[model samples]
Target: MKKNYYYIAILAFVFVFSSCKKMLEEEAENFVSPSQFYKNEAQCVAALNGCHNPLTSIFNQGLILANEGVTDLAFLNNQNNETRFELSPANPGMGKGLWTSAYQGIMYCNAAIQGIKGAPIAENRKPALIAEAVVLRALYYYVLTSTFGDVPFYTDDVANLATLEKVNALGRMSASDTRKFLIAELKAYVDALPKLRTSEVPNNRISSSMANVLIAKLAMWEKDYGTALAALNEVKTIYGALAQYPLEDTYFRNKNKPESIFEVQYTWSVSGLKKTTQVACYFTPPRTANTSTYNGINIPELGDKANPFTSVSPSAYFMSLYHVWDPRRNIILAYTYNGQNFTRPQSGNGTGKPWMGAKFWCPGMDNLADGNNQKVFRYADVLLLMAECANELDDVALAMSSINEVKRRASQASSASINLELTSYPGKVEFFREVREERARELMGEYGRKWDLVRWGIWYESIMNTVANEFVDIKQNVRPYHEYYPIPDNEILRSDGKLHNNAYK
Candidate 1:
């Protein structure tokens, strides 16, 4: 797989400090200190690549369990505590991996930003390079606060053991305040960042488009609709005419296309360097019962004989959201693929079977190693968010246009409608409900379903009302505090009581 060459730069970090703890344990005599390393532009860029490494670690099944598997869009059939709402500070399940990766990413970003600031590079050149690290730090915080809520916040680099100890002893900050700080920080550097599409950038590097989308995302979390809409509008203006970036590019046939705003890049090779994702195994259905040769459901490119692990399945309610006229139905969910039937036993709201469709399926899968980029932000998501903001701001016409554009794209022609107009609904509340459903149709399995529910003040209610059989335990075990996961017990122990767990009642 041909990947952006910057990924290769991450190899350079092997001689540098990998983490704060590693610094404390290992001597700097044999390693390249930050002061010795960040003197040149190439080293600064390499530090940015180091910041990107943790993304792969962060987007695994653990992230899915916390973000999507427990939500209305998908389910984990296993007895994982995250799905069953049985999580504790000690057994945070997937939350442990998420917290670890996010902080790891944050640490790398802080180190890069600190290094770049003192790098003797040209004054004009610093902003763009530093901008990448800044946005990346904000992205990590977005994940941290979105999942854990009110986490220990820091932007300082750990220069030595003392600084590391101070960071370790820091207390939690309010999620809202953290988000506010992130928004302001991102806005400060967004313009300094390059204005390029994912295709134009290497390895889906953070661009101005991604910053704007994230700004909108953070603003929405704060219920600051005006700010969110403004940021999204900036993206629409920059990207221009969404048709140029087709939805088909969203498929893994080729990644980092123009439509992609940001993604976690992956590459797999049997004879060479390989960094892969397990997303395919997480979504693909198991072999059909009473059949041999994997039931002919194999994707030809990936040695069709490989069977999927079926670790996660789409909820019946999520599958049922598709309209008969909706062209996205086939793209997002599958009853059949490549002339082979997809079948599963009765489960999850008793709707039987519908596998996670083409958008996520990996063709060249080996074992659980699939080389597909996990999408973080895309153009369609921006449009849907715009529609949501318009509804909240009472600009019904804008709301209709924003959502209708998404429908038109899905239908592949103009004049397609799904009752998104003001007159089509009784009032703004009904219109807002339609917007929620539209967002689900566009971004169900990608991310942010649980965050959407929580920000809209409906996570607990939505899960309890969902009729999926898989959600039975969740409904019985869920509480209001389940909206945010508990802090990992090890983190609390490490913090010496400065950090605390959620009040999980």
Candidate 2:
């Protein structure tokens, strides 16, 4: 089997950094010894850049499929077995890719942290760099724990090939322990990071606001509403006057707009060192050659050619939840086919149905790569999260204000009846339900659906009612174990029995 490109690059760096002087001197090949490499700031910065490369593949594919494909909002359309909740310990696509990418990213971060500490950089510059690496490591751990439950957690870099095998022997950390570690680590970094996005390190780099957002997400996952609210309030204070970060309708364009709090940066220009996103190819509709059409519709050409893989389709239940005039409906549901506005097919199997969410579509892009930055956190997401925290705290007034901010933005784009009034939802339960629905409407296909459902304690029941109904096979095939994906069989084998699958699985 061929080695993953990311693994090859990161492993090569590890050998360079940790290899002994005798090995470097005896070897006739090119190798930059750690002592020589850490003598300058440029090398340290280059090492930091390597840490971010794995995230490009994570956001472009693995994270999106794992989070969205199993949810009611969408399912993988490329005959991905994981979409049907048929994931197994040996499922390479769903389990192996994510596990490997996240851990490899963590290794790069650890190497960066160690290298930067010894580098002869400015005294004041060290804290921010170290903090950024720490926060990034926290993010990788958070993703791993969320998806696979318990995973082997480590902070030190694997010093040699032998050390790599020893590191694999470590046992998995408990989920609660992983969450506590992430929260504590994030809190420690918040003070060291820049309070706001700056010209030097914009939204793409980890800032205090981004750190707080991660804190809020972790807190919310644990249902610790008070902690989540505090972190969100800190984010609000940093951004200043929620009005400063109003929702932008064209937020999806790759301009790095003000609405973004944290986004993974990608570039169109290819280089040996640079990384790009593949969303435009995976999410955009295929076009035919004879006519500028898609699925028999004369739509304007978006991608260069019609590929075997197409956009992930929205579920019928998800499409039905929106009102006809809702502005988001137009943004998310409408797709042009044969010169007609087609949102849902008139007749067909519900699972295979096609619809477009314009947020991820990018016109005029090379094959499988686009410059559009993948949004990890946005101002709208923060507000909706605030609403959820406030609702849990029984602060109905705050909750209403928080959620209405998002609705207010949606109402402006189109005359869609998407407005929500305080009077319409009299009770807290009713209001919270609408808040959930609002999040689904605003964040569909953006990779928040499964986590939202899981946190709401409605993942199983919601699926049993919605998508499972249309595809009866789903209900029969799914089990409680399906909630979290199983650890890949290869990971288990590599661990030498030190790690085990989630107990529920």
Best by TM-score: 1
Q: What is the per-residue lDDT of model 1 for residues 186-250, given as tens digits with 9 covering 90 to 100?
A: 89999987777756765456788888888999999999999999999988887776667676787
Flag regions of model 1 displaced more than 4 Å: 1-31, 288-298, 305-307, 345-351, 413-426, 467-471
TM-score of each: 0.88, 0.86
Which pairs, if any, clash in model 1? 349-469
Off by over 4 Å in 2: 1-10, 14-31, 160-166, 198-203, 240-251, 269-278, 296-310, 335-340, 343-354, 416-418, 502-505
Please give the distance, in angstroms, between residue 271's alpha carbon in candidate 1 and its true position after superposition. 1.1
lDDT per residue as tens, model 2, 443-480: 77566677778777788888887777766567777776
